[model samples]
Target: MKRNIKRIIFVVAAVAVWVGAFFMTQRLLEPKYMDDLIEGALTAEYYDETTKHDVIFIGDCEVYENFSPVTLWENYGITSYIRGNAQQLIWQSYYLLEDTLRYEKPEFVVFNVLSMKYGEPQSEEYNRLTLDGMELSPVKIKAVEASMTEDEELITYIFPILRYHSRWNQLKSEDFEYFFKKDKISHNGFIMRADVRPATTFPEPEPLADYTLPATCWEYLDKMAALCKENDIELILIKAPSLYPVWYDQWDEQIVEYAQKNGLAYINLLDKCDEIGIDFYSPETADTYDRGLHLNLSGAEKLSNYFGGWLCSNYQITDHRNDPDISAVYSEKSADYYAMKEDQLRELSEFGELKSY
Candidate 1:
């Protein structure tokens, strides 16, 4: 009996040490992990807390790629942000809106309808969670506690263990300090892009005969639409800019139906491109040439600026023009816009506008 008690005591001490170390590693490494990956893991917690925008754009990856919050702040005086991800389908958008409404009372929240049409709820890999979602910053904790549903609040957004399957790999490393080191986060809180170069190209996705909505999506969407109505926030639904041929059949019609039914403003830029003469087809316009699933920076500028100008017409927001500090942050970002403009201006000046123009 005495020998058994000693063995039990030793086991208890070992367990105590292990628990202490795991928490120690997690606490020490948390800042760096947030700097590196939180933007993609947690939403509703991190992004919206630091976000001080008059307008916040939420959707799927289409929102991030196509909207430059800097440009929105610079040109129109309206502060905006893209809280988008790769697989933020319609249902997730509903939850996100519910989450955002807890703290941020932006003048307008833009929703991209692409994922509303094609994204899958079970396909979490494709689900886009932003640094905004995972931030454990003091504000992040409050945002999660105040805004999110008990399930998302407890599982995915705050703790993040339920969302990222790969986190265990970090735990297994030998030198595996749980801490990540990052040089910076932006003044306005979007993680600054470390590299000026373009991200890897994705191949054009194959066309599907019939694009269908996931059954789980309708409930969240219904909730989101109702939430906007109740709060009196103008919910603008846009069929985000994508290549025409790639957009396939009745895409606009389906989104249009949703928009009209919800009394949301819908912008179909594909159809609007006729008035603007920005061709989504033609190799010259599509610099990446990967068959139109994604656009190079040049294409993104045309689309973003066009949509930016269009969005400004509806909302009244703060002008960031006089903010020299904000200008400093954007100077490096202007490279993408400058490069794109050079091509467009040179093309226009040399040929006096192409067959498209």
Candidate 2:
């Protein structure tokens, strides 16, 4: 009996060591996203929020790069968060919403409509950028299944070490520096760019044979609408004022019809660029970082200010600035936001580009 007990303890010890080693290797192999491709770090940062948000924005780069949550809080005291990733698909957006519901529910969910143009998974790199930051859950499993390309494997995601094992020799200082903890890369899901690249020119958009958005996109969108309704959360659809990868009139019409038929509100910001004070033409006052592709700090703040007012007018979103608990949190966030802006501007002035942001 004593021999049997000793054998059992030995087995348990061996299993624990193996499990620890496996996870440690996984952590070591995964890209830190500290220096390069910092966008990959945005998704996981949401899990660290101490205070609840009144509004949640989920979509792609359009939502993340175009709106500033800090501006929303400062102008209207509207607490909000953006759960966006680069090229995040419609199905991925739906699944992200599902995952977010596990946390606090917001009064409103704002979705950018640009991702509807993609009917299928776009690329493996984009898939990793979005999914790697998500916590392991059923929603993540579904998202991975829905977003994987033909060459991707499920096991690679499950054990990222499998995919990144080759990175052993290519490892940088950040890989070890941020092994246990990662530095925050975004300001409440807003990627700040203080530099302005004026809209000089754009390639002509090619005419598509079919202007209709895919049924798969519509199906996921339907699910998003239903989920929001069930949770008593109002869903607002908006087309951000991006001047490239063109927002054709045909696509806009379909979104308009969907919003009208479902009694939802949809705003095409392109139509209101003049009213919103967005200047894409002037280099001195341009608010874009990549020639009208994504909004810079100036543009994001303007858009956030206008949208915050519209949200206050339309919904019951409260001004939480006076709440001591939430106020303390946001006050610190505001400081960090300004500090980052200062750093980016300094880098731009000295180097003619941003190096650290």
- TM-score of every model versus the real structure: 0.63, 0.98
Cα deviation of 73, candidate 1, in Å: 1.7
Across 1-357, the per-residue lDDT of candidate 1 in tens digits comes to 999999999999999999787656544433333334444543533342343556667776566555555555556655665666555666556656655666677778788777655433333333334333343555345434433433453345554433544555554332244344332222222322211222233457686776765454556566667787788777787766555335545666766787788778888765765554444445444422234444444555566567667776665655666777655545554564455446556665676552221
Clashes of each: 12, 0
> For candidate 2, what is the TM-score?
0.98
**Pairs in steric clash, model 2:** none
Q: Cα RMSD to native, each candidate?
A: 9.1, 1.0
Encode model 2's per-residue lDDT on 1-108: one tens digit a residue. 999999999999999999999999889989988899999998899999888888999999999999999999999999999999999999999999999999989999
Off by over 4 Å in 1: 1-20, 26-51, 118-120, 127-215, 244-246, 274-291, 315-357
Top-TM-score structure, candidate number: 2
Question: Worst ten-residue run, lDDT, model 1?
Answer: 187-196
- How big is the positional error of residue 78 in model 1, measured in Å on the Cα after superposition? 1.5
